[model samples]
Target chain A: EAGVTQSPTHLIKTRGQQATLRCSPISGHTSVYWYQQALGLGLQFLLWYDEGEERNRGNFPPRFSGRQFPNYSSELNVNALELEDSALYLCASSRRGNLNYGYTFGSGTRLTVV
Target chain B: QKEVEQDPGPLSVPEGAIVSLNCTYSNSAFQYFMWYRQYSRKGPELLMYTYSSGNKEDGRFTAQVDKSSKYISLFIRDSQPSDSATYLCAMNGVGYGQNFVFGPGTRLSVLP
Candidate 1:
């Protein structure tokens, strides 16, 4: 089966600008999650979406937001970006009602903020 | 203290050697444990998962969980150069809406 897919493998943006990352879940998955991996800082959860609704989010600021579509795909938006926002943004998907099975992750989008 | 603690080792070992990695968590509520391997600049792939305190083996990898001590371990036998990567331990409570907590990864390198 094809795995989760993320778009724009690499992105470059400047501080104060806005950036958007996209993710398409596996064919039958219904839950999508976003995570940020920065140098020195390990993987940090960003947001969780299930059946097109935002279920939960991490400690990140409001500027970091995202939405899931009807097809179970997701998009992450980071507004007023800062240098510290530069990191590898990973997207994962899992079947609803089965959290025991770990998520399947995409390679991730590398965002570089200058 | 953080929910999970792990040694961020840049451990180097020769091929065919045994490798051991571990993580300790403070939250007793966490019931599901997992080990993920991530190559540089790549996403993490699940290596082993256990629902409760016990041990599970897959090929050359073995995962052990000890709920009493809130500790977990991953052992790789006869390691290969292809096993070089960062290993991360994750866990979460059994309740709904509970999210997975991941440890700062430990980097491992196996030499030929």
Candidate 2:
């Protein structure tokens, strides 16, 4: 089976600009999650979408938002990006809404804010 | 205190050595534990998962959870160079749609 897939393996943006990272979950998966992995900061959860609804979010600001489309694909949008926003954006999907089901992650998009 | 605390060690070990990685959590409500391994420039892959307080083994990997002490561990037996990566520990409660709190991963290098 195909694992999760992310687009534009790498991205570069200037300060104050916006960045969008996309993800396609595996077949039959319905929930998508977004995370930020900054250098030395580990993985920080960003957003969670299930069945096209915003289910939960992390401690991120409103500028860090995203949505899951009807097809279970997701897009993570970081608005007015700052230097601190530079990090690898990861997307994962699980078979169910519960955390115990485990997540399948995609090769993340490396976002570099200049 | 942070929900999860992990030593960010870039530990170097010889191939075939036994490796032990650990993390301590502050939240007693967390009942599910997970371990993820991330390669360079790639997303983390789930390595192991366990519920409550106990030990689960899969081939060369073992995961242990101690709720009383709020500690979790991942053991790699006969470690190989292919195992060189960062290991992250995560935990969450029984609620649906809950976020899996993650720790700052520990980097491991199994030198062949």
* Candidate topping lDDT: 1
**Residue by residue across A1-114, what tens digits does model 1's lDDT show?**
999999999999999999999999999999999999999788899999999999999999999999999989999999999999999999999997687779888999999999
**After superposing candidate 1, which stretches have Cα over 4 Å from the reference?**
B95-98
| DockQ for candidate 1, C-alpha atoms | 0.72
The superposed Cα distance between candidate 2 and the true structure at residue A36, in angstroms, equals 0.4
Ten-residue region with minimum lDDT total, candidate 1 chain B: B92-101
lDDT over C-alpha atoms for residue A108 of model 2: 95
| Model 2 C-alpha lDDT per residue in residues A1-114, reported as the tens digit of each score | 999999989999999999889999999999898989999888899998899989899889999998899999999999999999989999999876555668889999999999
lDDT digits (tens) for residues B1-112 of candidate 2: 8889998999999999999999999878888899999999889999999999999999999999999999999999999999999999988885534678899999999998
Query: Weakest 10 consecutive residues, lDDT, candidate 2 chain B?
Result: B92-101
Find the candidate with the highest DockQ and give its number. Answer: 2
Recovery fraction of native interface contacts for candidate 2: 0.80
| CA lDDT, every model vs. true structure | 0.93, 0.92
Q: Which 10 successive residues of model 1 chain A have the least lDDT summed? A: A96-105
